[model samples]
Target: MSTKKHKVLVANRGEIAIRIIQACVSLGLDFVCVYTRADEASGHLALARSLGGPNAAYRVSSYHDANEILAVADHAGATAVHPGYGFFAEDFRFARRVAERERSLIFIGPSWRIIRSLGDKINTKRLARSLSIPTVPGSDRPVYDELEAEEIAETLFAFQAEQGISNSVVLVKASAGGGGMGIEEIYDIEQFKTVYRRIRNYAKRQFHDEGVLIEQRIFDFNHLEVQIVADRTGTGIVHFGTRNCTIQSTGRQKRVEIAPGFRPQEVDYAFDAEKLMEDIVGYSLAMAREVGYDNVGTWEWIVSPTGQPFLMEVNTRIQVENGVSAAISRVRGQGGVNIIAEQIRLGLGEPMGYDQSNITFDGVGIEYRIIAEDPANRFTPWVGRIDQFLAPTLPYASLHTHIPMDEPYEIPTEYDPNLALAIVWGKDLAEAKKRGVDYLDELTLSGADGTGTELKSNVRFLRDKTSTILQF
Candidate 1:
């Protein structure tokens, strides 16, 4: 690990790219940005230009092209590369390529060896079992063909029948997928072959992996995740404060809240929250140590109605809802450790600056992902130029976006469905909900009038009172 200030290359775009640029500026480090041709005039590129110094920006055909991104990094003399959130953030091959580089460029996330071991869902579950961590019952190996899928389905059905249980739904998920993609639900055992084939095809096309993993889908469960940060020396801290992401409809996160309020009147599940948090933190750290994980990562779990917490998966990159955790730490007087800065320092062989005792959750935090889609029209893609964009200005509230304020605000053509993120912290869950709703009400994005615009946003949906309530 080199102790010198590094020149980092941002290999992704959108709000995350802008966030990394800000982190670089704060650390007094040089950074270069790569963008697609469609984003030549995007707000993120403009931001890089405005913060010009040793920073350089390049245009590539695709953000997923590892070779082209490395070429630009090499030409710009970047000492490190940051793959923010999506795209190549968890790409083991990309990490390996960076590590194998002749010029010695650092990959800001986990080591390639660790990524290769845990990137596969099946392998990760097996690792959890080896470590005595509870996991959802499912196939212990990858399902490569329809026969294997049918066998696993029969096995699960027999097991459920032996236990005298009905409504046992199983999920066929891609072994190498992330961001809630490459998953299909199988409610009936007879439908396993067809659904498995479809899922495998989808997985191959999308994730470039035909291998699939089967898991017992627990209904009426809550989705929770624990955030963890570690260094090469094995020092780590688990932000025990959990987040409730159970308000999703189609397995996609619409809204997320930290320190989820569990009303006894709402659900039947009963457990000691403190004990659960301690167990989760211990399990996550044990797994991280097993894999030699360094940098920031998340451990996701699905808690059943019976209060049984099962490991779902592990995210090897910074999550989209990171602002909520940061706000919670900041309000708790923990100085809101900058996760990106820690990643850089860990890659440079520095010990974790803080320990577990330094972490304290003081308040409630919530985050809403404002995507450019029509909720009434099956969440169809809505893309257009913005004539006006106004976000709310509130204390303890943060907005991460690249939407510009000019005569004509145009969104890039080649990008994901996300538009922006609004994160707010409050004294408690109720106050957080109120602040979040107010912020959403103040957010405005409209296209040019009389332009026959089909563009829409979820701002109205997020502002609705029902949006704040947790629903399974």
Candidate 2:
């Protein structure tokens, strides 16, 4: 067992695994990756070894089970495990098990305690309030039934000060949901009844939590968020700047995400874009210091029309835009990704080569998630193997995808179709958007080719029609 080279089990698939594997290589560490029955020939596995050294090992098996991954990590004598967002990335129980594994397999990212705390939207709201961060106006606890929700909403309407509501529509949301699941917009009791039942059933089936929360939804608002990183020693705290994701639809099934959305022509961010970025970074840093936050975390927020910034939620893992944001950080001379690596090093009590001041982000980068669903057909998700895949190459942009080249990419219906991420970076946001359009135009697939040519055509058509420039 070579103590000098850390052996890390990459308990994830897709572009994220490739990203982490690259980081491991940069640190001169040994790489280990696992795949499911469906992903035995995934690009993630191939890329992991292609970038790894001869000493590096790759395993293809059923890592579909959390316990299964743990057993493999234990048997492989892995020193640490990195869950690269998605799959079991935010699973608190999985994190706990990884930590409990013998031979000291450090679980990358925040402690299991923090994951659980942030996983529950109610608990996160309470914590945000305690820290003086304005969270979405909602009940401090979960709502049990329609009657309970109606009472809460009516009370809020009457008091007007309870949830800052002066007879306005509110969003009924599930405490445990991501990717826009278990949510509905309601105005009256009838609407509430219709939406709540559907949402409650979805929540119970998805998260086993029938309890939901009612929050004041911001309409026609520009969405802004800050990405923060905290070190284990509680010494280094940094923010990687802000991203505007305003382009959205009120649709329940599918919503469009435009990164670096056009500057709000009407309303500005709750805080000065630059100031809010720093403040959010500062607030999260202070909170992490108090609570001993470790690894990567993001303080999600939305800026209202009145320029009041409200904390929406906190994600205790590498967020969906992590790679894109990392590109931004590197261009700005900030160490977003480096900080995470340093935190991992410090948690292990190992000397790290992290110079917070020296790290820089080089260009504006945008990533568009290409899902395996038809955008025109109510965004119906297409499952099964992808028979063919033809990726695009943009100017100064590279594709980090899961679709295997020259082979059938077997995609299961069990998980989400993060088929590929079209990552494009430019000298600025404008160039990134142009590249994104071009990249979207060029992506191709077969049976499970992710939203197919028609999807790309619609996106491009809309981009041209809107003449509206946004980079994601």
Say which candidate scores most in TM-score. Answer: 1
lDDT of 1 by residue, 377-407 (tens): 7666677777777887888788888777665
Query: Which regions of candidate 1 fall more than 4 Å away from where they truly are?
Result: 1-4, 53-55, 236-240, 249-251, 257-269, 330-334, 448-454, 465-472
Candidate 2: how large is its RMSD? 4.2
Q: Report the lDDT tens digits of candidate 2 across residue range 1-472.
A: 3434777888887777776777777667776788766666777777766776433444545555776677667666678888877667778988887777554578887778888887566777888789887787778888886898877766645555465665567788887776577778777655777788888998999889888888776755656666666666555655565665554433442223333333333234454555554665566666666666666776666766566677777778886666666656652343345434543555455533454465454556666656666556655666766676787654566666777778776676556666766666767655666777777667676563444532222344334523344321
Maximum-lDDT candidate: 1
- Alpha-carbon lDDT, every model: 0.75, 0.65
lDDT of 2: 0.65
Task: Work out the TM-score per prediction.
Answer: 0.92, 0.83
Clashes of each: 0, 14
